[model samples]
Target: MSLTAPARLGIQLQPQHATYGQIRDAVLRMEDLGVDVVFNWDHFFPLSGDRDGLHFEAWTMLGAWAEQTERVEFGTLVNCNSYRNADLQADMARTLDHISAKGGDTGRFIFGTGSGWFERDYDEYGYEFGTVGSRLDDLAEALPRVKARWAKLNPGPTREIPIMIGGQGEQKTLRLVAEHADIWHSFVRPDAIAHKLDVLARWGERVGRDVSEITVSNELSRGRLDDDHADALYDAGVRLFTLGISGPDYDDAPVQHWLAWRDRRNDAVGVDAA
Candidate 1:
């Protein structure tokens, strides 16, 4: 476990119940608040609140965010691999990477991807809502193509955009994470993290890759930063902690709370967090 890894904070500004202007402001506010990464989910519809609500697309908004902020790395919390062609996805990611690269610095784009699971999204978006195993198979097939396309692009990505794979399935997901992911993100609880990492290690050994360097990430959506939950995640070897906030009024209180906790955690470890 990489317990010595530096702690970084992230937020998913849910694009529901708000206009693009509000979402744009929230992104700027989060960047100004010193969050390391800002994420938004890839879904055509809202995951919470009213089923029919004002929401925005993920990748296009990401392009805007790419040009909007200078320092904070941004991407989909986990892109649905089933929606677009793999090669096209890579091209889009590479473009965003270049767009975010300003003042001669590497782009701050993280390619966080996952196999699609939301049936409603698939049903409405005219995509196949296949079974979980089949969707995993599609992601397994797509990832290699995405990588290949990246290598073949005319002006390649500014940096090898970090791949963050989000899932907790002990079998296929762990294997995929061991094979390709730079960051393994999960909604798994602290107690379950060790068990999952154990599973991941076995997969790593199978794939002949050392998985210890892959940054472990977990979401704080289930508990407040003031609770022991965040610390428990830290103890479980999670270096990236993210909270999801929604719109209408994107509250900064939680972001402030998380920022304080992140500062304290990084300071305790003598890590100079961005």
Candidate 2:
């Protein structure tokens, strides 16, 4: 199996009641900070304490992010696949790919996605939430269609848009990752992730693919990923670590340590050259 690892740092800029101007500036700042990838969650409204809170739609901001940032690759950490028509999602991705590649380079876009989760999103928008199983089933069905649409779309994504699947259900999600994702993001803790990854490997074997092509990623939680804890995740093959922070008022304080750790990992793991 190939053993190449992804660059070890990404930052998720959560749109927690932030003004568009603030978010725009923050994206530029994150690129300046040498972050590899910048991400935003896909939700119509905030998912935090106050449900009835300010928020922004995912793709519109991504188009702006594509134009605003010069270096860092950007994407939604997890766009809800069910919200937009799969064909439309393909079109949006294709346009953003060109937007990011404006000056003549391969696109810096990762098409991260997951099945829709928030019931509020469905209830308000008139989508059927159905069952969790049903949603995942829909995701499994939609992914290939989305990919097919990507190929058929005009301009065709300036580059291959890496597919990022986020979830940890061993039965369904991991299998989907083995079959489709170029990257897999999950909340699995380091130790638990080790076990689950073995399952993913088995799925890869079953499907005649190499698991190494899929980078393992996990959330970089402030409360959980202490210095030693970060090391543990690295040891478990989680090279793409993402720190999710909030807005209106942006704070990089919680992520400074993680950033430092990423540098340290780079030094030790050859990401210094990435």
Candidate 3:
């Protein structure tokens, strides 16, 4: 099957293990490189070893990224919905939406969220990281409330901040994706992704929503996956791809390949159109 033109390409600039100065430079470089979206993980500390390692808060850095970047859309890859009240999250998203849209383009913020998993994050932060089922349930409940709050908000979310839900749980997460997410993010391989897409479609059917309306996104490694893998994913209805990189120095090499692939995808779409 021929892939459709992707809506955009993105990269996650993880802020753990990096100095603020380095992060600032990398964000600037990514904008120059032509990435459509730039994301950072929402975490208090490094997800990897040395739990005490240096890290920056997600939203605070997002505010800074809004000022520092010129063209790249910025947001948390997936904020833990369990950590903040849904109303507060909606308000924060609205505020940042305006901040990112200061120059008068519809806001570039995607309110990415999920029922968080990390046990340490829950224990240390005093959030309930109960069973995965419970978390997903909470997320499903919170999402509509968020939308309602967004509508009631004074600024009314610069341009309807797109809601992105990240996870690969076939039963629950995929259903949430079908029901709530404007974009669904998964890290599974192509074959797994294909199967899950079927599951998501089924869920969409149950909920009376078109699965195609939800964007499929996945986390990519720096050249670790094959080039054709992108074509495979795009054919499977994943129009948005995200590569992950760590800072102090956000290496430009991986992002360059992503940009190249994005161009190729666009070119292919043009060919198909002709």
Best by TM-score: 1
Candidate 1: stretches off by over 4 Å? none
lDDT for 264 (candidate 3): 79
Q: Model 1 TM-score?
A: 0.98
TM-score of 2: 0.95
Deviating ranges (above 4 Å) for candidate 3? 1-3, 222-225, 271-274
Worst 10 residues of 3 by lDDT: 1-10
TM-score against native, each model: 0.98, 0.95, 0.92
User: Between prediction 2 and prediction 3, which has the larger TM-score?
Assistant: 2
Q: Which candidate model has the greater lDDT, 2 or 3?
A: 2
Report the Cα lDDT for residue 35, model 3: 87
Which candidate number maximizes lDDT? 1
Candidate 3 residue-wise lDDT, 65-139, digit = tens: 887776678899989888899989999899888888866777778899999887888888888778988998999
Clashing pairs in 1: none
lDDT of each: 0.92, 0.84, 0.82
- The TM-score ranking, best first, is 1, 2, 3
- Better structure of 1 and 2 per lDDT: 1
